[model samples]
Target: MASSIHSPNQQLAYQQARQHFHNQQNQKIQIFWSNQTQDIKQMNDFKNHSLPLARIKKIMKADEDVRMISAEAPIVFAKACEMFILELTLRSWIHTEENKHRTLQKNDIASAITRTDIFDFLVDIVPRDELKEDGLGIPRVAFQAGAGSSSDHLPYYYMLPHHPSPVGASGMFYTAPQPCPSLAYMHWPQLPQQEPPKTDT
Candidate 1:
């Protein structure tokens, strides 16, 4: 018996399917920067100690026109303010790199917030139209030609955006594609359980 060859249409379909698979794999890889631990630690310290306790309290007292603040209010506010600064800086840095700019600019911060939906509440405060006026709508620098090297410290991951929390309001986190190892085999009573059926002897 002779082995059969694929028909012309079948060959074409196979080639197209293979090409589609490669395209889908490529799409799954998104480029992003690796975290800088030194910068994170420095920012954490600044968040904790950069603001004076007295000043935070003083500002709270000044808002007595329509509000009252407890002693713990200043502490909370200071911490929140620090986190806000760090969040904005991180977001702006991402945009700067995305625009292929080495320097972080005010406009980059605006663009980041504008592009991200979580910052929609701040849209009224940031000038969205000014991006075009300032020529920032276009990436400041073009990607280097013939630079197929992945030496730019770029990394890729599969993740989904998490809801805003006090600590992770930035929503940047990695979620593993597979089931968690620790919980994969755990059984819970809340889940439906089946007991062995008994038949009359």
Candidate 2:
């Protein structure tokens, strides 16, 4: 019987192929939130205040569960817009020296939003715990390319306001995609046992 063989190079190639598949599966989903119309007033306010638009976007995106509602969505969009402004404002305040190096902690987010009555309209809407401090706190230094060593620390805890408690909610409000399984093993399969060629043929 002829035998099948795999060289070392072939094995290496197979491993690399599997890694590529896993990487592709783990790719994160990106959600974008932009102003529908040029709110000259808001733009001018931000510019004059030196608020960091880039950082704001980063914060929103980092929270994988939160998505940017489209401006055309009216109610939901409005709520998200309010949240954005409140978040930016809180970030600015936390970064201020008076905050004692805390940066704009997550708790600050809840406090700011609640104080501003941003999500007050929804019935039974309260602060959600899942949005609490991420433990990473705020960046000690400005964020720049190759600025400094990366820190794996979790963000600090902050307040999070939720409309429905996880227990009270009818169904889960946030739904995440299932993790994609690894495809590395797909390249190799067990060969089936075969009987010797028929001698009487």
Candidate 3:
């Protein structure tokens, strides 16, 4: 029994470190949900948005099958983008902590993507220069990603933009995509505020 307790401290430390991370994340999830609930309850300000609705609509329209988007769709997509950013950052932060670093490096995000099955969809999105396969033919990282929620709507789930870089036969390195700060601060109204459309009645 005493021998079992003498295992390598590095492994023990990592276990403890991740446990602490999970604990803190639980608290964050609670606050996140609370804020989302509040936003849903008080979402009357359609005129103001953190992301450019026009750009979002343009992206959506790029798909050949997508035509005639509703006014509410862009608003939903903006919220989804915000949530995506939060999730990506949260996963990357875990890798940063594992490496005993405070700053979230691009590698941390790449590692997170490789380790997370759900984020597997994003493997293709990461640049080839950022990630390389380990000796075991796997991305050189280890970890888990999780989300807690009971109130997510169906459209919200379907609308989240997922662009995981694909792991290829070459075992190439995949770099994390740069975050677009402009999206979150695009508060300026690009279009002129015109009167509501007239009805034929």
Candidate 4:
């Protein structure tokens, strides 16, 4: 109801203020962490996560191939998952704030993933709206750090000594996937083409 009364500029200003406050809070948290040397359990105790470790373990064990897991595996996986969730949420919140909205939406998640390079692995999962004139959406190409060329995104393959293929059999070659281009570096406008210097050939 309050949204109906606020002008677009007002909403933008509000969002900017909110984002500034959150950024300051994050900086404070980082400073506090930097001052402390803590164990993993102590860190976990300091931060709250919503997901249950048992559920994550159940999901991990659902695969028939995964017969056994170490006792510490679930705890490690749970913490990793919690951190992942926090990162995604913070990134999506940035998008929401940019849009001048307090509520987070699915589009915000897509925008966040599209803008973050590390999240490029999820490019195939996010759906993009089709533009009729273009026939397709933006190309799903990402730039991999330290990769010599940007030809194609590929997966890595492993050769297990215990499960070696026959000598005459063809070996699988895996390609590595590229990380998505960061939007922080994507804000340049195309420069106007200058006429080539008039030269007498």
Per-candidate Cα lDDT values, in order, are 0.56, 0.43, 0.66, 0.61
In terms of lDDT, the poorest run of 10 residues in model 4 is 148-157
Instruction: Rank all candidate structures by their lDDT, best first, as comma-separated numbers.
Output: 3, 4, 1, 2
Candidate that beats the other on TM-score, 1 or 2, i.e. the better one: 1
Please state the error at residue 78 of candidate 1 in Å: 0.7
Compare the candidates by lDDT and give the number of the best one: 3
Runs in model 3 lying further than 4 Å from the true structure: 1-17, 127-201
Candidate 4, 1-201: lDDT as tens digits = 355776778767866775576677467546544543353435746234467777878878765559998867887787677667767777778667656899998867776676666776666686444325455665543334433223222322223356444553457643334344354468789899999899898
Tell me, what's the RMSD of every candidate?
Answer: 20.0, 24.0, 18.1, 19.4
* Model 2 TM-score on a 0 to 1 scale: 0.21
Using TM-score, give the best candidate's number. Answer: 3
TM-score for model 1? Answer: 0.40
Q: What lDDT score goes with residue 10 in model 2?
A: 74
Task: Mark the regions of model 1 whose C-alpha exceeds 4 Å error after superposition.
Answer: 1-48, 65-68, 129-201
Model 1 error, position 175 (Å):
38
- Say which prediction, candidate 2 or candidate 3, comes out ahead on TM-score: 3
How far off is residue 13 in model 4, in Å?
16
